[model samples]
Target: MRRAARARIDLNALRHNLSVARAAAPGSRVMAVIKADAYGHGMREAARALAGLSDAFAVSCVQEAAVLREAGITQPLVVLQGFKDDAELVEVVRLDAQTVLHEPGQLACLESSHLETPPAVWLKLDTGMHRLGFAPVEAAALVQRLRTGDLVAGHPGLMTHLACADEPARPESETQLRAFDEAVAGLPGEQSIANSAAVLRMPAAHRDWVRPGIMLYGASPLIGVSAESMGLRPVMTVGAPVVAVKPLRPGDAVGYGGTYVCERPRTLAIVAIGYGDGYPRHAPSGTPVLVRGHRCPLMGRVSMDMLGVDVTDVPDVRVGDMATLWGEGLPVDEIAEVAGTISYELLCSVGGRLQAEYVES
Candidate 1:
């Protein structure tokens, strides 16, 4: 807890974000995506915080699901990426986690298993992402096969992922949705397609289930917009402490690579966070960071353990002053933009070393 770097998660903000998803996609069951440790906000803690609010928990692997189960979280979990080996086959059943079957070998694995029970399976259709899931024709055939094979007698669902829903104006959104519809036509089970982007933009895609990932963490999928713009709040504030203070002369470069030259004599504060802690290395000079509630421009190449910021405008900024990388009043989207990525990457890439402080409203 004494470390200069930390990420404080607002458990209440996480709850509020889930509430927002529930309201946005009314009448549909909500499955909160907690993969990558709830996008690096701590899986068990985030699952515990959202235990009652979420209809189900979703993670990428059985290990993540087991963490929730160990914490007494009994909500049904759907593995976004299905099993890798037969060992997971038993774990899926034992953990009672559902899985998305996207490969031919997975179906064979399920068919070969003689266990008394098989975990519920969600058929994943490629739709348009083309990353995972079966082709439209193959997906249809697989669904029929599962229905006939008794592989998922108790529960079954159809799920698809969106690649361009974040850009509402992109034609791929509708194309993917239509492809998913055609693939699952006449299938007698629940349907899910929307991620945070679709939930906020493509209402028609909101079907029986809404799998919201980034939105649950209170960050926007679309650039230059926020949940508040859509009536939501940010959940996590990655904070660090000012470790060093130095006065820089005009034209003097600030950090390694000398990419940033001091425009004027200014006091620069070095924050104890950098690419090693998952702060983007691509973050160019002049990227904004919050110090003492004042906006300061990040003024150098991000190093392994520290980054320099121009704090000339921030009154009373000193060593050990709290600097907010994002959250609270700071918009994560703004920081993510400076990092040349989306909020999702910034949130998920935060390393495990950062101490997480969960604050319930």
Candidate 2:
């Protein structure tokens, strides 16, 4: 079935972005974060595309990792949230997956498990995120317990999440780095702290493994640094076709609520996309949409299955013309800004109804 709205997934662009991450942190291994279904790009597809390139894969939970395993992915999978209970721990062991020991209860659960072979573990230090991990002061003692308990396979690697690596001017990242370094001062294991933002900006945080999430999908993690400027290419392009075109007289209202009134005689193109297809309904007028290779301004409110675009200046725009929501010539970030959101939300929010096409080259 041909869907009116579609998203094109570019695997070549995905590889290019992975290369960019490798170049940014030459000494660190890349753990591609594929959580949230690879940021809604489709988990198994993304894992397959990145299988050979990524040193390892990181997901939010065991179920997501199981998807990759079922897809025949052999790369090591890291469960960021760790196991919720001993049953999940058994599954982690069965899948040969690694896990992060972020909280005291997780360690307690592991201590009680009697698996013949335990999965490798990463000890998360709280640093300052406060969302996960043990306090820096308590991390060393926990690490000691894990090492002596024989509950974890191999020495547990040290990991921390940075609270403000995207904000270069802030000292929070540096402070966290200092705390992480001190906590794991004499401990023996790999250290990791850099996420996508830190992988590109903070070299010091790229210790052992660099977890690149949004950057792997070619979206900028920092507010000021664009993906293109960082040598990254977008992997997804969202588009829809124009369903109707009409002439509007001055003083005529368009769409529901009559919020937008044509100031003068103009040509309007009705695009077959809207909030129902994951286009942000909150996107205000003047959002840019490309029609027939020409930039057109979106007018009025976005409806459930359509949107209004001012095609008065676009030459010969007609029904069946393709309108690019974002990708290629249009950056998703720009649309996200006009929508009062971020590109991550825009990409992840793409509805299931929209068809997806994967391009290898």
Candidate 3:
């Protein structure tokens, strides 16, 4: 018998979330961000599912873009981080992938590395994120530089990352938007400003293009909002089978560090998943896991390959019964909250130990 965790990927749910983004910003073009292996939902499958719906696709690097090209994804692909060196720049051109020029060195590389045909490029403006992009004040000069450069395409698209779009009440997004607008004022080419949060909450940031990342995977982008309320369905439903069961008395301790002491007569269902299988090791006791469609509280500490859950309330609980870690009936956000992390970390951290099951429905 196997003791590995499993992730059920629903392609329909992915498409539905993409539709939500599109519906939120009907005027702007959709650049579906499929980086980090489509945020651990399988990049190839996600690309195939939303091929016709998205105007473009985005990945962190050129290698990821090549994967989509090889999988017969014909839509325009944008390399979000862009090429780091000439070799990657060559591959970007060969794969016909668009790239972002965020710094002077990258522009210098582009100018030095001449190709037969220039790929489309996006100029990142560092309005406030300060991670990538050039100084917002230099937006006009940067645009002029790209337009006048030998290796640039027809026109470089203008884009910037939002610093606090998730916190809609914060003024940072407004500040960033204002800076981006002032920097690229009357500048040539398309402007992209909104991310997933901006797409759903901050409508004013929606410009020429909108990039949606986590929302496409059916995870909530807002802090307190649920994905279901935003018309999104969970795409990656993860679970593991119960391998062993044990009865504990009121004073009985469980798992490592004896973090949980039984308060009453309890039946514990030991699950076949833990930190080793990408289940958050920090998820403490009381974190909910769905067993037989009933919510069971996780007990004690999580080990490398196993975790214990209080299944006393579950009637007819037995070994080999499935216990859902997240997704399906259990929202990943709930688990993330208890673990003190984000849904993105959980999704991307799914290790090879767990088997991935992709389904159409």
Q: Which is the leading candidate under lDDT? A: 3
lDDT of 3 at 144: 79
lDDT of 3 at 12: 90
TM-score of each: 0.96, 0.98, 0.98
Q: Please write out the lDDT profile of model 1 over residues 1-361, one tens digit for every residue.
A: 2356888888888998888888888978999999998898889888889888899988998888888888899999998888888888889899888988888888888888886886798888888898988898776577767867577755468888999987888899899888988877887788999998888888899999999999888888765566678777888889999999988998998888798887789999999998889889889888888898888888879998889999987788889898888888888888887787888899998866678888876
What does candidate 3 score in Cα RMSD to the true structure?
Answer: 1.3
lDDT against the true structure, per candidate, is: 0.85, 0.90, 0.91
Question: In model 3, which runs have C-alpha deviations exceeding 4 angstroms?
Answer: 1-3
Q: Candidate 2 — which pairs collide?
A: none
lDDT of 1 at 357: 84
Put down candidate 2 lDDT per residue, 231-250, tens digits, no spaces: 98999899999999999999
Error of 3 at 29 (Å): 1.0
- 57-131 in candidate 3: lDDT tens per residue? 989998899999999999999999999999999999989999999988899988887789887899998988889
RMSD of each: 1.6, 1.2, 1.3
Clashing pairs in 1: 227-232
Which residue window of length 10 is worst by lDDT in model 1?
147-156
